[model samples]
Target: MDGGRDSEIAMGAYQPGYLATRNRAARGQVHGFRVALWQEHLGRDAAAEAAGDLLQPSSLACVRRMNQVAEKHWAMFADDSFRGDLPGHLMAYPVGVGSGGELLNTRDKFPDTNAKVLGTKSNILPPILTT
Candidate 1:
């Protein structure tokens, strides 16, 4: 659901209610989710950097909240089907570029998001690459 870009970009790809980024309050939540993971797993400062965000960028507080939520979910999922068996705070990522979070065991091991060196910001789009 959240594999592609932001609000309008995400909405265009699916029917309504398909994903959390479906509404305005859910706006910036994708960044918040990533912030949560990075803050908990790495640290707050690192999370901010990966997000290209600042400590008081207005939504940074929301970022912290999302991190707390994910951490809490990990704790409360004692035997839940989604993430009970995972070793630590890490969430499961999808397999390859377009797998769309297939499943825990079915997909490949989650990649380290920290290691992703994304393409530079550009007005003209970069050359596309396929997996």
Candidate 2:
């Protein structure tokens, strides 16, 4: 939201390609797919290092590394470079999408009958302070 300010802008590159699930295998937001995939690449000793950066956006490292692993049951892969071939500028934001939705168990998980609560009668924030 800081559109304008004569100051240095800092960006953290933690990364973001991990498949999303309601389930958690590690700490907050760590993907199980990423954990196992990384585990295979690293030895007994610094395997944790591979698990560290699963969230880097459009992370080719995650995709490529996952495909290399022998176990395919937990892995889902198709692209060789996994969008690595795309230009760097193109990879910034909104360049891609998500994992395969298991079209079977999926119903309208957010049923329209009950999801209207977000815009319900009183979801208000305290008014912003002014200078």
Candidate 3:
């Protein structure tokens, strides 16, 4: 799972097997699921600046793969201000906060990795968001 301060501070709440930093949120990632950093700094250290005004630092954790499925589905429950699709196969909902992926059936899947975003030219809406 890839999440924010909540995931970093209290990962036990999410219970993810392999975790990444969700670069879009915190600008960091796990290397081989071993090491994690909030953000990479060159000559000077900017951990404080990069952290912005967060109350806590970002999280870094790892473990063996937990769930193994033939397919993966991603979903998002983010703040209302967020206005875009998730980085991976995940889709966003105008709500709370969550990251990473979850198991789902094919019929209930959001979208496969190959799914594409629709534009003005396409009249059909993505079924992922439809019930």
lDDT scores in order:
0.42, 0.35, 0.27
Model 2 whole-model lDDT (C-alpha atoms): 0.35
For residues 3-35, could you state the per-residue lDDT of candidate 1 as single tens digits? 443321222223344244333333355545544
Judge candidate 2 at residue 126 and give its lDDT: 32
Model 2 over residues 47-116: C-alpha lDDT tens digits? 4543544444246875654443323311222223343322111111111233664223222222325332
lDDT of 3 by residue, 1-131 (tens): 23323322323223255343555332223332212222221101322333332212332211111010101112232233445643232122212323555432333222333332321233476533321
TM-score of each: 0.22, 0.21, 0.16
Name the candidate, 1 or 2, with the larger lDDT value: 1
lDDT of 3 at 131: 19
C-alpha root-mean-square deviation, candidate 1: 15.4
After superposition, which runs of candidate 1 have C-alpha atoms over 4 Å from their true positions?
1-9, 12-58, 79-131
Candidate whose TM-score is highest: 1
What's the lDDT of the predicted structure labeled candidate 3?
A: 0.27
Give the least accurate 10-residue stretch of model 1, judged by summed lDDT.
6-15
